[model samples]
Target: MRLAAYGLALIAGLAVTGAPNPAPQVTLDRAEAAPGEQVQVRLTGWPTGTVVIELCGSGGPARCARDTSAQIHVPGGGAGGAPLTVSVPPGGCPCQLRVSTLDTRFSVDVPLLVSGAAPPDSGTVRQAATGPPVVVGASVERDRGWPARFGAPARRTVVLRLRNEQAAPAAVALSFRVGRAPSPTGFVAPPAVPDLAPGEERVIRIPVTLPALALGSYEIHGEIVTAGTAHLVVVTTDHHPWGLAGLLALAALTLLPTRRPRRSIGRR
Candidate 1:
């Protein structure tokens, strides 16, 4: 019953955003490999003046290689493309190849399983604990036209509403970075407001001065972080009636007695 509530809450969150759904983009076309041999990884993408490609081994944070390149120059306003190579290690453990846009400073993660490893069996992986629950959504005024004043820019008010749904109060902090294509070079102050009460929300209005040169696609991400707290969202899986019935049957068996305990061997 508790798990079902979490699912419903997650669904409701989507409705509140009202923002266009955006999907992560990957430029890597394919990974080719031979038995016990090295494989070549090729990636292609956009807004490309310069970029970096990193290779991580066995799903761990350990980086095997960090290759910086300026040769990925897009031609005739074409999409970005680049090719890099990584030697397959002795074992068949899967590896992760990450690509980062140098100028725009965005990153994408891709997983590459080693050649000839057995396919994984069908199963479900569930998070053991739900992390700190932080609600996030963005707002933009569509009808408001861009102001044309030429001096110091006006402070754009960005209000982040944070609600602590846990039983106890939480200390919340907000950290954000400007999206690519007009990224904020310098840091912003008071990354977040702290000490939010349970079942309570605080709207943090950050006054930001847009650079005169700022333009185009911008994105802001906010997260609430605390020590020893789960920082990722937890989602509940669906429960079927058959599964519930099975549990109920098992519970009944615990109460039933076999052969009535020999009728207690009563006298008379």
Candidate 2:
């Protein structure tokens, strides 16, 4: 029931911005394999372009073995393409097969099992005893022609809505970045906001600016960092090249002599 409510809330928030484009599908011939062993991976329903496939452990990039990764070029509208062989990284079982676009506008992760991995001990698990629960959601103003490009620059602000549900107060600094993927670059970091009282809600607006010539999908990511824990949020936008079709049609029209009037009759 909780999962369903979360899904409904997410859908409501992004109904205006539209969901991300469909990503390529991935399949592994074998569910479990020993480390350093190669497995056959099948791909299909790929609309187009290139993506990176890598193996990662539980944590973030720090836990991922970067050496065990590959860049796969997917054919346009691929239909059950040839199998791709990828070796399991050094990290043991309980890992993820990660696939993401170069810009990271779209991403998918599949569970991967590697032999000889030790499961987490049930006795050593820590419960959430510190820090208030922060619920974060982000959205772009699509109603005012957001994501606009071609004729007018497509730049907009991302509104971040945060609510603390628990009884504990929170004093955290907010920092974020806009990119194809979340990395250390071009960040809008402000000093820590006033301490948030228990069960308080706050709204923060961060303006996003993209290059005039920039084209393709982008992401707006925000984070609230504190000593006890960190809260992260993300929203998506695009710089759609609406003039591409018009440009192509114009070029074709130029190649046709019949479409031109008799302005050059005197020269002939």
Candidate 3:
């Protein structure tokens, strides 16, 4: 009788543990792309049991790996978004993207267009030059942290102040460069107007954010472009962490400026 009871208990435990749970399904919601332009692909409605996901072309045999496969996790009934930056391969063609769940065999297809270059945004901001001696503020590293105030999980707003000491109103363009990659061209923040009346001063404050920012020393600088002169100035001083992972992330940011470093004479 004791042997039979132990056998029955073992059978019950195995039956309960062997049940299959529904896996999280991954679907490619939509592709917002520009021909010859790198775009972010977003996914939605993911279920559980998906350890890995991959993208394959329906028309072509090319495949794009998940930027950070484990970065975004989905168990059952969870949703997530992944930012994929891929240069649309040459030519005008329709690319079908199939997103698959490695374990559950769940997937979806998204159609994307590889078209011409993206249109430029003609937004401009100007700042005037002023002063006998324009005194620039110096940046000192804080004792608390490398980027104590500017580190990761930061607020979206970046506040900066510019002083123009000249008597004539100057149209200055506010520009930013992280490492060596220049900020997106054609997107200029409105400038701070400084009083150019010799002793008069002006303060300009601008706020902006970079998508998917990584760890590094991010320098916010400005260039005052006039008829025949250009003044480049570094404004803020904030140092983020520089670990192995940060080095890798900065490597990615550096590549962003490669294709659009300067306008191509051939494209124009």
Candidate 2, residue 42: lDDT = 69
Clash counts for the predictions, in order: 2, 0, 18
lDDT of 1 by residue, 34-75 (tens): 334444445443443333454555422222232221124333
Q: Write the per-residue lDDT of candidate 3 for residues 162-228, one digit (tens) a residue.
A: 4445655443323333333344222224333322444444444454333233444445554443322
Q: Which residue pairs does candidate 2 place in steric collision?
A: none
Q: Write the per-residue lDDT of candidate 2 for residues 1-268, one digit (tens) a residue.
A: 9999999998898997797766578888788877667767667766554555667666443344445555555655653333334444333347777765544566677887877765433342212214534756678864255334344555667776777665555544455666776552444433335456667888867666655655777777766643335577777777765675577779999898775566655755
My TM-score estimates for the predictions, one after another, are 0.31, 0.40, 0.28
Residue 25's lDDT in candidate 3: 41
Instruction: Go through the candidates in order and give each one's C-alpha lDDT.
Output: 0.44, 0.60, 0.42
Write down the TM-score for model 1: 0.31
* Runs with alpha carbons beyond 4 Å of true place in candidate 2: 1-133, 143-148, 151-153, 166-168, 182-184, 189-192, 243-268
Task: Give the lDDT of residue 80 in candidate 1.
Answer: 49
